[model samples]
Target: MARNKYDVDEVLEDKFDVNQLKRLLAYLIPYRKRFVSVGFMMLSASAFTMLIPQFFQKVMDVCIPNKDMKGIAFYSFLTLLAAFYSAFSLRYKIKYTNQIGQQIIHDMRYDIFEHLQELPFSYYDDRPHGKIQVRVVNYVNSISDLLSNGILNTITDLCNLVFIIVFMLILNVRLTLVCLCGLPILAIVIVVIKKKQRTAWQVQSNKQSNLNAYIAESINGIRVTQSFVREDVNSGIFNNLSGSYRKSWMRAVMFNFTMGPSIDIISIITTAAIYVLGVSWMINGETGITVGVLVAFTAYIGRFWAPINTLAGFYNSLLTAISYLERIFETIDEPVVVKDREDAVEMPPIHGDVAFDHVTFSYEPGVPILKDVSFHANQGQSFAVVGPTGAGKTTLVNLLSRFYNVDSGRILIDGIDIAGVTIRSLRKQMGVMMQDSFIFSGTIMDNIRYGNFSATDEEVIRAAKTVCAHDFIMEMENGYQTQVNERGSRLSAGQRQLISFARALLADPKILILDEATSSIDTETEIILQKGLNELLKGRTSFIIAHRLSTIKNSSCIMYVDKGTILEKGTHDELMAQKGEYYKLYMSQYASLM
Candidate 1:
């Protein structure tokens, strides 16, 4: 429920984070050479284009007037050659820049995914999965164009603008001066639009994230919605989110669209003024401005404003991308709280000697899930943790596996501090089967083999049989090869649990954890499952968290936990004789059955 965020754009941080953009530059460092080369190519192409006006001036002012056909033909041929090379050079520039963008996206996505894998369970506990999913997929895709052509184009155009201005000044400074006057009006418009455009886009990005969160949540809970006949209500909520996103997008684009037209209109007005003023000056025989020079000057004016238009477009893209980059970099910047230390060492083969020395932990600060919980399980011991829901039964086993670091204490395996050992090595020797059995979309055999990739087919089948999964599996047409999607929707709850149990067994871990692993399985199946688990659990320190006292009666020690502390601990008969919390819990279940 905490992960379900239904609100749309509830809290919008309108300010742009420049640090995120600076951090993103690190991804470009590796391909800086390619980007530089692309810029160089674009600049070279612009240089050839700048020559076209000179070609025009020569024909209008000298070649045509002298009636020299050879000179006219030569300039015409040169212009054609320059145009062809300009077009050819631009092709490679576009090709290589986009390729670099794709590579950066791949690297960034991989880093986010890798970090997500290492993040603590608490990271996922606080945020909707859709919010996280958008950053890795949609948000990364949104910034690719900004990285691809935006930077190179912005830089190349400015350089080209400068090159064009120098030529314009050489032809006629009076007209060039007229063109410079437009820059002030364009600057004012940009200053007016920049803040509004950025703020709008940030809001748009928030609405988009909210919409995706609701969509993912809806899809995941569609069955429940249909069962409760709440489809209409759900659709209404979705429509609201979709409408909010659309409105924000329209608002953002309105500001972004203003940039290009404003530049274009200012450019044309500036051009007209120059032409009119130049003609009058020439008509009055003042300033010595010629017809050929006037024609070339107007052409240079077009070249100059073209880059300003490009810059306007680039600024728009930069603002949009910065909105997305904030989310993307935010994910990359997330800390991995439970991770291996720099000096951590790989754990040797586990002999199942696990000890919790006054371990205290909490998913949230100031509220403990397990307070000062200390226990020792020698090799081959089975410890059953029984408690009311939310009383830290599952948390005990979660700590044993170091899924979350202890807030105030340490956990040890065979006298080695778990925090000092590499997490991959520590977990490799442990098998955990939780209440939720997440089956990825794949063949059943592949799903089981996920526990241990090197496991052979024979080993996989044997593990499946140990949990009574092989029979139902064989009943299917494809048996072991049957395709089961994520969460194993095609399989019944018990069948999915059996496969997950088999996956744990396939890992052949020294320490086994079963937290309500049999809750969905029927009593008959559980009896058979227990029989196999009893033998497989031999010489392995196993922690079983079950409400059904019948399953844990044989545990070496049964701890009755409540309110983050153990209320009772002993064998079933010992606790029943003591008539403690464990006895009361067992009797209540017995009374219900009777």
Candidate 2:
């Protein structure tokens, strides 16, 4: 599979449908009441802001000229009231907007996470861990600013512009026309800058995502890098990534920085023209042209151009935001392809009988991983699968877990077709111990309890003792309260495997699977694990996949797999006596073990 790049630059140049954003906004439909309240508060704030200039006009023209104390007091009080209303309206809008933003993030994050969980194993196989991490954290965070401040500010700015334009026209239509003359040129400049800014911003975003992915991959592989002494080489690569990110960021900044000054120059030229025209009208003794009106008109001109400038800037931000919104929506909109069918029934308690009838599967079309595979294990039977690497041993266990459905054929448990059963119930009866045992950052006791969250302390201890993990766990600095660190980094690989074994044992599953479960352990630990395994597999149907033949030499049936086909099946002794593929593989490993 090809690697995916989070390069924002490339993503930004690609066209995105506006319909996706419309659909994303539909998630806020249930919060319309809050939206309405926020809108009202924003409008109220704008109205009060527009009223402030009118009051200044009154104080200058009417109150000062009349020297009327009562009128001055009343207008001053009205100004104070308007200020309070503006402050209150701002407070309400800010509070509500934050709530709306957080709610949207909460919903979007959950939707993305749940969708990820529902995606098939094949989907994960094709996707990198770093890319998924970027989607969950960085991509989700970017949208919060868009939903909260960006949306609210865009709406408020539009309303303010409309009100200011109408009020200015009402004051003097001729002067309003002069002030508005620069708008068309301003609008054209804004459109050009916005397009360039969007492209640049996209590039920057992509670079940042790539850098993040690189960092995540490097950190996770620190042990390998150290062992190979590739620190200098890795640093050089990191420097290259950082350099590319910085260059992209500089390009975006250049475009954004040009916008404010270009708009300001236009505003300056228009203001000069307005001054010349307004002074000429005054000299000609145009009726109703007061000094106060001229001053207020200039103030309105300032207000007009400021928003025009802000609108230009906002246009660029909106494009960046839209890009982010598209990425976030893409993840949430991914289809849940592994959902249960409407007619699928909840599975009953299992009897440990598992059968695969002529099963066939492939991760990709026309490339079979398991072909015409048939197997049966009666209740309490121990079945072992031995194979060369890439012989579909682990794939068989994945099929039994229904992580991937068969391309052709069916699996049955307790005489019921697994396809007809709900996945949740079907998986509930199985316990798995994989080669790379995952231990979360928590106490040993807490990790064991993860297998069955409802298990009591006594049950947890019993399970630990069954896996011979209790003694080592108790010797830890804080016993059951000891922190494991991320991925159990503080523990040896063998110790981590023991904890995972205890966890699986605690679950008390009817069927058990061990995939190279003791491959990392020393001889002494493997012997202890083997004894515990004997006890654990006594009454449960078990499927063990092992590269080490000694581990499964006593199983009820041993199957040798080669190139996605079952080459032989019989008791271990019988396979040795046959002197075929199994015999050759066992003899090769037996000679090496000596």
Best by TM-score: 1
On the 0 to 100 scale, the lDDT of residue 282 in model 1 is 91
Question: Which digits, one per residue and each the tens of the lDDT, describe model 1 over residues 1-594?
Answer: 133465935343333466677778888999999888888888888898898888889899898899989998999999898888888878998789889989988998899899898888878887888888988999889988888888888899999989998998888887888999999999999898888998899889889999999999999998999999999998999899999999999999999889888888998899999989999999999765888888988898888998889888888998998888777766766778888899999999999888889988888779888889888888999999998999999888888788888898889899999999999998999999999988999999999999899999999999999888999999998999999877889999999899999999999999999999888999999899889988878889999999888888899998889999988888889999999888788889998777
The CA lDDT at 91 in model 1 is 90
lDDT of each: 0.88, 0.82
Off by over 4 Å in 1: 1-4, 8-17, 592-594
How many clashes does the backbone of model 1 have?
0
Candidate 2 C-alpha lDDT tens digits along 1-594: 233543323333235687877876786787878887888887887777787677778878998999987888987898898888888988888888888988888888888898888877776775556667777888778778667666667777788889999988877888888888887887787677777787777777677777887888899899999999999999998898899989988998898778788888888998898789888988999865677778778888887877777676666666766656666666666556566889999999999998999999998889999999998889999999998999999999988988888998889999898888988898888999988899998788899999799999999988888888888999999887888987899999989988998988988999999998788778787777788889999899999998878889989999998888899999999999999999999889878667
Clashes of 2: 5
Task: Mark the 10 consecutive residues where model 2 has the least summed lDDT.
Answer: 5-14
Which numbered prediction scores highest in lDDT against the true structure? 1
